[model samples]
Target chain A: MFSLLQQAASTAAETDTHAAPANAEAAAAAAAGQGADAAHAVEAAGAAAHAGEAAQSAGMPQLDVSTFGNQIFWLLVTLAVLYWVLSKVALPRIGAIISDRQGAITGDLMQAEEFKKKAKDAEAAYGKALADARTEAGKIIAAQKAEIQTELNTAIDKADAEISARAGESEKRIAAIRDSATADARSVAREVTAELVRAFGGKADEAAIDAAVDARLKGAA
Target chain B: MATEADTGLAFHPMEQFVVKPLFGDGPIYWYTPTNATLWMGLTLLAIIALLVFGTRGRAIIPSRVQSIAEMLYGMVHKMVEDVTGKDGLKYFPFVMTLFCFILFANYLGLLPKSFSTTSQIAVTGVLALMVFVGVTVLGFVKNGTHFLGLFWVNSAPLALRPVLAVIELISYFVRPVSHSIRLAGNVMAGHAVIKVFAAFAAIAWIAPLAVLGIVGVYALEVMVCIIQAYVFTILTCVYLKDALHPSH
Candidate 1:
C-alpha cells in the first residue's frame, strides 16, 4: 500500500499498516511493546483497531465517514488559507498588476492621442502661418507698387509744369526782342528819310513817318 | 483471495484511494496532517509562487510566469464577466479562488504517488455547496421573490408550467450533487482507470500494451484535468448568472 511508503522512516518499519489495519496494529503493538510503555502501547493498539474498523466498514475510503471530518477539515483549512492568501496577497497583487498594466496601456494610448492632436494642431498653425505670411507679403508688394506709381506720377506732373513755365518766359522775351528790333529799324528809316528830304529840298514829316512804321508793324511786316 | 491464488494477480485499485496516516500508523484524526495536506500545501505554495512572487515586478511587459498568472486571471475574469455580465464582476475574486483551487488541485494530483485530494467527494461536495449556498443567498438577496421565477418558467403554457417548475426545481437542487460528483468522479475515475491499467502491467505478456494504455490515459487525464476545471468554473458562472437573472 502507498500508506507504508508515506509513513515516517522510523515508524515505517514498526508499523506495517497496509492490508488489515487490525493485524497491522497488532504487529505494531508487538513491535512497540519492546520500546514503549504498556499504557501508551495499549492506547496505540486500540486506536489502530478503531482505525481498522473504520476502514473495514467502508469499502471506498472516500465514502468512509470516519475520514470525512479530516478531509473536510483540511479542505476548509486549505481553502481558508488559500482564500486568505489569495484575497490578501495573490489576488490583489495580481489584480493590481493587471489593472496597473491596463492603466498604463490606457494612459499611453491617451498620451498618444494627445500627441496626435497636438501634431494636428501644429500642422494647422503652420498652414495658417504660411497663409498669413503670404498675405502679408502680398500686401507689402501691393503697397510698395502703389507708392512707386504715385511718386512717378508726381514727378511727371512737376516736370510738365516747369516746361510750360519756361515756354511762357521764352515767349515774353521774344516779344520784347522783336519790339526793340522794330524800334531800331524805325529810327534808322526816319533818320535816312529826313536826310534824303533835307538833301531834296523838302522838310521831313516826323509824325507821318512814325504812323507808317506803327501800321506796318501792326500788320506784321 | 481465490483469484489471487489462481493467477497470482490481485488488483485492488481502490486500495490506492484509501486514506492513511502520514507520520505513523495511528488513527487519522480530523486535524492530522496526511498526504492530502502535503499535496494541498504544495498547491498553495505553487499558487503563491506564481501569483505573488512571480508578479513582484509587475512589469508593464510581464515576465513569463507573470504572463501565465495574468492569463489565468484574464480568463477567469472574462468568464465571470461574460457569463454574469457587469454585476457578476463583484464576485470575481470568489470565482477566481474556486477556479484556481480546483485547477491547481486537479493538476497537482497528477503527480506520481500523490494523493488526489480533489478526488474526495467530501472536498468537492463542500466546494459545490459553498457555491450553491452562496449563489442561492445572493439570488434571494438580489432578486428576492423573483429568484423563484427561475423554477417557475412563465413562458410555458399554463398547464405545463407546473410540470416544468417541478422539473426545474429538481434540477436546481440537483446542481450541487452533480457539480460535486462531476469533479470527484472525473478525477477518481481517471486515476482509478490508470491504476487498473498499471496493474495489467504486472503480467509480462501484456506489459507493453498496458504501459501504453497508462501513458495514453495519463495524457488524456491531463487534458481532462484542465477541461474539468474549466467546466466547473464555467458552470459556476452559469449558475451565478441564473441567480442574478432568474427570470430566464
Candidate 2:
C-alpha cells in the first residue's frame, strides 16, 4: 500500500509538470481533469484526517485525562450560568405567577363561600319571619273566633232571661184565672142547688142545700 | 473520480467527537475555546432563549413559547417534588439546570455537523459527581452519623445485614459511574450509530439505504435525547431522596 501510494504521487507530479505548458486547449482539459483529481485527493485527505481523528477520539474523550480539565472548567462555567438563570430569574418569576394564580383562586372561592353563607342566613331569617307572621295570623283568627263565641253566648243568655220573665207572667195570669173560675163555679153551684130545692113540693132547708152543694163541690175537687 | 476511487475513502465515524480548538489549530490549553466549548455555549444560549425570552411575557394566558417554558418548569418541579417530596424542591434549580443543559445538548447534536456535548463522559461525569458529592455531604449534614444506616439493611437477618451493607456500599459508590455513563453512553451510542450510517452514504449502491437508516436512527435518537435527560435528572432526585431520608 505504501509503495503504490508513492508511485501514484510521483506520477501525479510528472503529469502536473507536463500539463503546465501543453497547448492551451489541451492544458485546459488537463487542468479540468487535474482539478477533478485534486478535488478527489482533497476529499480523500479529509477522509484520512477524519480517520486519524477517529482513532484519537476512539474509546472516549471523556476518559481522556488530558482534556478533563478543559471539559470540567467549561462545564462548571456553563452550569453556573444556567443555575443563575434558573434560580435568580426564570424560576422565581414562574413561581410567583403560579402562586399568584393560586391566591386569586382561593380568594375567589372564599368570597363565594361568604356569599353562600349570607344567602343561607337570609333564607333562614325569611323562614323565621314567615313562621312568625303565620303564628300572628293564627292568633288573630283564634281571638276573633273567641270574641264572636262570647258575644253569641251573651246574646243567648239574654234571650233565656227574657223568655223566663215572659213565662212567669203567663203562669201568674193562669193562676189568677183558675182562682176566679173556681169561685164563680162555687156560686153557680149554690144557686142551682137552691132553685132545685124550691122547685120541689116540700120546702128545702138552706143548711141542707148548702151542705149538699159543698159536698158535691168537694167530691169534684 | 477514477483516481480518487483508487485512493480508497476511509470513513471514520468517531471523528465527529474530536474536541479541537475553534481557532487556528494550537495546543488546547485549559482556557482555550474548543468545539466542545462552542456547542456547550450554544446549548446555554438555547436554554436562555427558552427560559428567559420564551417566558418574558409572564402573561396570565400564555403564548406558545411561554406555555412550553411553563410546561418544562412544571415538569421538573413536579418531578423533584414527587421523587424527593417537598424537601427536594429546594434543589429544583440545580436539577433544572442539569436537565436543560443535557436536554438541549442532546437535541442540538442532531443538527447537521453539530457536536454533542453530553456525549462526552467528562461532562456527564462531572455532573454525576456533583450530585454524588452534594448528596453525600447533605446526608452527613442532615442526618449526622445516622446516614451510614442507609447502607445497613436493618430489616435483613442479623447475620446477613453486614453482607447486605457491603453490597449497598459498593452500589452507593457506583451511583455516579452508572449515572454518568447512562447519559453519555446513550447519547454517544446513538450519535455514533447515526454517524456510521451517514458514513455509508459515500458508497454509490448503498447510499439510499444509508439515508433510510439515518432517518430511522435519527427518529430513535430524538426520543433518546429527551429520555436520557429525564433519566439523569430523575436519578439525581432518587439519590437526593436517599440523602435527605437515609434510614432504610
Candidate 3:
C-alpha cells in the first residue's frame, strides 16, 4: 500500500515537474486567471488522498487481514517474554518474600504462646506454694495452743498441793501450844491451894484444884 | 470532515492508528517491523523494567520499583486465586503475562504519538484466542469427557435441556470474540475520540470546549485502559475456573 501511494505521488510529481517548463507561459497565465480555483482543486486532491489513507487505516486495523500475522507474531513474542520474566524471575522472588514474612510471624506467635503457657504454669505453682504455707502455719498454731493449755494445768495442780501441806503443819503446831499452856495452868492452881492451906488453918485440896483447873482449861480450848 | 481537512482546519484522527513500516515506505513483509512492533517492544521493555530489573533487589523490604512489582504480582495472584480457586492458581503465570502485557500496552498508548498495540484487534484477538485455546485444552486435559458437561444444563427440565445446552455452547464460543473486541474496541474508541477532540482544539471559538472534552476523554481513557486490562485478566481466570472445575 505504501509503495503504491509513493508511486502515485512520484508520478504526479513527475508530471507536474515535466509539464511545468514546457507550458510555463500558458500555464502561468491560466494559473493567474484561476489561481484560487486551481489551488482549491490541488488542495482537495491532496486532502482526498490523505483522507483515503486515513480511512483505510481508520476504524479497526484488527479487521485488516494483511497485518494479522505480524501483530500476532509480535504479541506472542511479547507475551512469551513477559511470561518468562514473571514466572521464572519476579513471581518466585515475591512469593518467597511473602512466605518468609508469614513464617517469621508464625514463629513469633508460637514463641509467644509458649511464654504464655510458662507464665500460667508459674502462676499455678506460686498459688500452690502459698496454700501449703498457710496450712502449715495453721497446724503450728494449733500445736502451740495445745502445749500452752497442758503447761497451765500442771502449774495449777502443783500450787494447790503446796498450800494444803502448809495448812496441815500450822494446825499441828497450834494444838501443841494449847496443850502446853493448859499443863502450866494446872500446876499453878495446885501450888496456889497448898500456900493457902499453910497460911490459914485450912487444908488445901490440890487434886480438886488441879481437876477444876483442867476442866476450865478444856472448856476454854 | 473532508472539507475541514481540505481547508487545513482539521487533522486525520485515524492516521495515528496506521501500521506504517518504521524504516521506509516499503511493502510490509511478515517479518518487517512496523510502528506496532516498535511500541510492542517498548511495552516489553517496560515490563522488563518493572518485573525483571525492578525486582533485581529481591529485598525483604522492597524498594519502590520492587514494591510496585510485588504489588502487581500479589494483585494478579490474589485475583487468580479468588476468581478461580486454589486449583486454578497453576495457570497464574499465563494470566499474569496477559494482564501485564495488555496493561502496559494500554498505558503506553496514552503517550503522545505512541501506538497502542492492544488497540488493534490482531493483538487482542491473538491474546483472547490463546486464553480460549489454553483453557479449553486444560478443561479436556483435566476432566476429559466431563468437560462437555459445562455446556449441559442438568437443572433444566428435560425438554429445555438441549436448548439450554445450545445456548451455553454458543455463549462459550462467543467468549473469545467478545473478549478480543471489548479490549480493542474500547482502546481504539478512546484514542480516536481523544484525537477528534484534539483536532477540534484548532478551532478558536470551541477551542476551550475541545480542550475540556479532550481532558475528560483522556481521564476516562486512563480508567478504561486499566479496567480493560483487569477485565481481560479476570475473564481469563474465570475461564480457567471453568476448565479446572467443569461444573455449573
What interface RMSD does every candidate have? 5.5, 9.1, 7.4
Candidate 3 residue-wise lDDT, B128-235, digit = tens: 999999899999999999999999988889999899999999999999999998999899989989998998888789999999999999999999999999999999
Query: What lDDT is obtained when candidate 2 is compared to the true structure?
Result: 0.78
Candidate 1 has an lDDT of: 0.78
**TM-score for all models, in order of appearance:** 0.78, 0.69, 0.78
User: Between 2 and 3, whose lDDT is larger?
Assistant: 2
- Proportion of native contacts in model 3? 0.55
Better of 1 and 2 by TM-score: 1
* Candidate with more favorable, higher TM-score: 2 or 3: 3
The number of the candidate with the highest DockQ is 1
Every candidate's lDDT: 0.78, 0.78, 0.77
**Clash count, predicted structure 3:** 0
DockQ ranking from best to worst? 1, 3, 2
**What digit string (tens of lDDT, one per residue) describes model 2 on residues A21-130?**
22222223223344344333433322222322322222233433445667789889999999998999998988876677778889999999999999999999999999
Q: Residue-wise lDDT of candidate 1 within B1-248, one digit each (tens)? A: 44456766656666666677789777777888877777778888888888888888878889999999999989999999999999999888788888888999899989888888889888899999999999999999999998999998888899999999999999999999999999999999999889888888988999999999999999999999999999999999999999899977
Better of 1 and 3 by DockQ: 1
lDDT of 3 by residue, A34-101 (tens): 33433333333322223334322222334434456667777777788778878898778778877877
lDDT of 2 at A40: 38
How does residue B132 of candidate 2 score in lDDT?
98
* Ranked candidates (lDDT, high to low): 2, 1, 3
